[model samples]
Structure formats: C-alpha cells, structure tokens
Target: MTPPRLTPVAERAVLVEFGTVVDAAVHAAVLALDRALGADPVPGQVEVVPAMVNLLVVFDPLVTDHAAVRAALASRLADLVPEAGQGAVHEVPVCYDGAFGRDLAAVAAQAGCSVEAVIAAHLAGEYHVAMYGFAPGYAYLTGVPEPIRLPRKPAPVRGVPAGSVIIAAGQCLVTTLTMPTGWWVIGRSPTPILTGDPARPFLFAVGDRVRFRRVGVDALAGTQSGALPAPGGA
Candidate 1:
C-alpha cells in the first residue's frame, strides 16, 4: 500500500491524507485503512471517517498521543492492500426530463451535445461513492466522464428538491434533502439518498459502485425512492 501523509488535526486526531487528487486507487486506500482500523483498532481511536481520498481518524488524546497514533497508522498500513470489500452496487432510477432537471438543457449546451447525449453519458459511466458529506446520505461520486465534466455554477441556486442529481467538479451527487447547490441540476433520482431509519440510513457507502438508470416520472409514483426493497445487496 502507498503510504499516507500523516497530518495532525490537533493534539489528538490525525488526518491520513492519501492523495492530493481523487483517484480510484486513493479511494481504495482510504477505505482499506478505514476497514482495518475498525477490524483491528488502535488505542484511543475515537472514530475513523472516510473521505474522497483520505481518512479522518479521531482518537482520544488522553489515551494516545499524536506520535502513538501516527505509529499505529503506519503499522496498520504496512501490509495493507486496497480493497473492494463486498460493497453494494446500486442502479438508481432518475427523472431527467422536464422541471425535475431544469439544468439539463444548460449542461447539454455546455457540453455541445443534445440532451439525450448528456443523459446517455451520465448513465454510461459507473460511478464510485467517494464519500458522503454536505448532508446526511449526500454522496460525492467520482467517474463523471471527462468529456461531460463541468464546473460548479458561478452562482449557487437557492434550493433544489430532494432526490435531485447534480453534476459538477468532475463528479455527480444525489441530493439528500432540499438544499441549495452550485452544481448543475442534471436530473432527479427516484430513490431518497437519506433516511431516518436506523437500520439503513444511507442507500450507498464508500467503495460501492452505482449506475444511474433513466426512469419515467410514472415510475416514481407512490414509491419511496429511499425505500429499500431488501436489506442489502450489490
């Protein structure tokens, strides 16, 4: 495994930065370290949070100092291997037409392609859940094909409906709640990304692969998008 740069988050916690850019290998390393820490923990480890290309390890300062934390991380990663660890695969249905995707036309114009082409590109690429943030169950996904990648809008939109799937910064996201955003609102997902249920709060997890499946508005009727059909599966 590639070594991570050990940075201090304070006197206690440590941020294990794996890479400067978001990459598949970096994501794998992040998750690998996360699993290892949970499976065979270091002393005073308070929490192990995974991000796009790094892991935030919060430990109890009283029990373990910075040096000890660093040493534990190094020891744990010494023989570590990047993993794909039984993560789930999700085929989320999306509504890309009409008001649900107000920015579809804009994205198509920016990409210099037809609306159909933009949707096709999104559906074609298999995305990885790099991390979740900005809100509960709100995931930041990578693997937006380079050809269609766009920057966040110069100005942010006030609020988008929950289930909106926006794209920007070479990534895609499914909104967990009604919130304002700078990313282009390309579509709306049929499934709710966040939930109050304790059993399954988020539909996806880091390392899980997802492919967006275009769906008609009728399909979303009466179906709770976040409604789990089954407990767990890829």
Candidate 2:
C-alpha cells in the first residue's frame, strides 16, 4: 500500500507517512527520504527522523514557514526510490548470563523453550533498525521472531540498567541509559551505541541492520580492542 498523504505533525514539523503498516516497502521509503534529506538538506530543514513507517521532517520556523517547508518536502517526495532495505549488517555482541540475563529464564519459560533456544532465536534473526527513540541511541529493531513476541511487563520497572536488550510486540531494543521500560529484558551489552558525549553521541542510524551474538559476560566486560567490530553491521 502507498503511504498516506503528507500531514502536519506539529507547528514546525511534517510527518510523511509511507504507510500505516510496518513492512519492508514502507521502511525502505522512509529511509530513502531520510537519506535524501541528509544528502541535500532543505533550506529550512532542521532534522529528519525516520520512524517505524514515517519520516518526520523538522523545519526551522525562522528560516521558512511551515507551509513552505511542507510544500518543498512534498515536492521532493515524488523523487524518492525504495532503498530495497540494503545496508551493512552489524553484529552486536551480548552477554546473557547472571545479572545481564536475569530475565532470560523468564522469557524462555514464556516461550515454552529452554534458555539455549531463546538465545538461539534472538541471535539468528536478522533485524532492522526501524527507528531510534525512547532514549538516546536506543534503536527500535524489527524482525523479532514469532515465538518471542511476549508482551511487556504489566508494570514497568522503576529503572532498567543500561545496555539491556529488550523485546516486546515483535520489536527489539537496546537501552543506552537506565530507563523504565515495559519490555522484557533478555540480555545486556556493554559496548552500547549511545555515549554521554554530545559531540559523539548516537552511533546507529535508521535502516541499519543489526544481529545479536551471544557471548560470555567476561568477554563483554573485557577490553573490546579489536575484539568486536564496529557497529556499522559489517
């Protein structure tokens, strides 16, 4: 299905929805628009965020009015070509033992599988970074297998530690900061993407493909010098 017509998201932003549903075609279109905005930022463009199936264009009201910016974006939307979801595949190492994977047993039980089966299912799936939100450098990934589509906790935890790998509603998320989340926590990774530095903050971009590899806790805490590759999904 084609995306819905462009609409005003806010006073200074427009939401270009590719479709109401989450699918490969919609996701690719959103990424293409996001790439186009990045490659050739419009005069009034301030930020372009790629969500699950929508592209949000934030504009500078002082430089150009909202209507003008929206018109400009709408004009260029016709030139977009579906990206085919092509991108580098990053491998994110995760430690799934002890405190890192306190919820692993629980998740496995819910899935009616062993802990090993849970780990295998999560690691083997090819997931796409659908959107980056809910926190700094926190990526909402798609392609969680059917077996692991457990609902979030009835009550969210007061604080979930950083680097926690969580799953809910067929999506996966990695926490870069300690935040309350209703999703089930499966594991943790120390080399999380979001850094505190404003200068070098988020590492992953929208449309980046990611895969999780189960590793020992000691390996995760040890020096990552050349141990793990960069996050570009190579």
Candidate 3:
C-alpha cells in the first residue's frame, strides 16, 4: 500500500494520517513506523507523537527546512515493514467499589446491564495502548467492548484522582494525574502510572497491550504486591 497522505501541522510539525477512524491495523502501523523512524530519524527531527490515526513528527526548522523533513518522512513510509503482533502485555488491577467507581450505576443502567456486568465487560477484553496523550503517561486504550463504550459525561468531572479507569467514545483510558475528564469513571487503578524515575515514567507505552483484572477493595494494597504474575514475561 502507498499509505495515505500527509498534512502539515505547523512549521515544525506535520501529521501523517493513516485513516479517518481508529483501527488496530492502522494503530500498529503507526507504532511500527514510529519505531523505525526513531531508529534512523530524519535529520533535525525532535520527536514523534502517535495518535489514534496520525503520526506527528516534530522537527527543528533551524537545523533543516520543512520540505526536507517531509520528504524524508515520505521516503521512510514507502519502505515501511509490517509490525509483528508483539508488544508487552500488562495486567492492570482495578478496584470497582462504590467510592472509586461512583458512576458505575449510571453506566450500567445505560448499557441495560447490572453494575457487575459492566465491570465484567471492561475486564474481559485485551486493550491495547493506542497512544499516550491527553496527559503524561495517560494511555488511550483500544478494544473496549461495545456494551461499555459509554460516552463522556455531559458535565466533565473536576479533579478525577490519579489512577482513574475511565471509558469514553469506545475506548478505555487511565489517568496518571488528578485531572478533569469527561469519560465515565468506572474504576480506579492501584498502579501509579507516573513514577519519579524518568527512565520508567510510565507503566504503559504505545503499542503495549493491557488487560484489566477485576479485584476487590483489598486488592488495592497489592499495587506493589507484585503478587500478580507478570504478563508475557514482563
């Protein structure tokens, strides 16, 4: 495939959009290209940020012109290779109690199912980290089942605590910091996503697969328990 087309984002950045909607194949393509580009970056490239269906390449105008950087990206895309279905699969534990998941009843009602059913659906699928954005280390996950693909709250919540498990627009997302969000808060993760250590700032990364393991309130204590077996040998 010739891929699709590229559009200029700004003087320093350009967006390469794979498609108009989110899909696993396109997402994998974006991550594969991102890794390939990083290994042999375009001259003057600063960073590459992958989104649902676009790859934003940031370059330095001082070092190289926009035309030169864009041309390099085009050439790289032509020689793209299909990525293996390989990535670190992580098991994130979440507490679905009343205090943490206040919106559970509403969400369950909207889905025509009970609260336990809602939790079951959210925990049932293998979600992939499409991209880390909207906040530092906050992952945009794919594979949220249709039953629990609830829309964001009509009124955005303020100060949703860190480690919140939220679902919005057919995707599951987790917060790394206390922030306002429109997504329905379904549960809270015990894992701290952002660490003080820069080397391992995030618990998840682009292309990584995550499976939410349903647990009780006491399971929160096991965040550092290391009790859960590592997924995929991670």
> Compared with the true structure, what per-residue lDDT tens digits does model 1 show for residues 148-177?
899999989875777778999678998877
Residue 96 of model 1, lDDT score: 81
Candidate 1 lDDT trough over 10 residues, lowest sum: 225-234
**lDDT at residue 41 of model 1 (Cα atoms):** 91
Q: Pick the candidate with the highest lDDT.
A: 1
lDDT of 3 by residue, 135-173 (tens): 678788888898888778888878777777899867887
The runs of at least 3 residues in candidate 2 whose Cα sits more than 4 Å from the true structure, single-residue gaps closed, are 195-200, 222-234
TM-score for model 1? 0.90
RMSD in Å for model 1: 5.4
Per-model CA lDDT versus the true structure: 0.82, 0.78, 0.80
* Model 3 misplacement above 4 A: 221-234
Compare candidates 2 and 3 on lDDT and give the better one.
3
lDDT of 3 at 196: 58
- State the lDDT at 116 in candidate 1: 91
What C-alpha lDDT does candidate 1 achieve relative to the native structure? 0.82
Maximum-TM-score candidate: 1
Error of 1 at 111 (Å): 0.6
Number of the candidate with higher lDDT, 1 or 3:
1
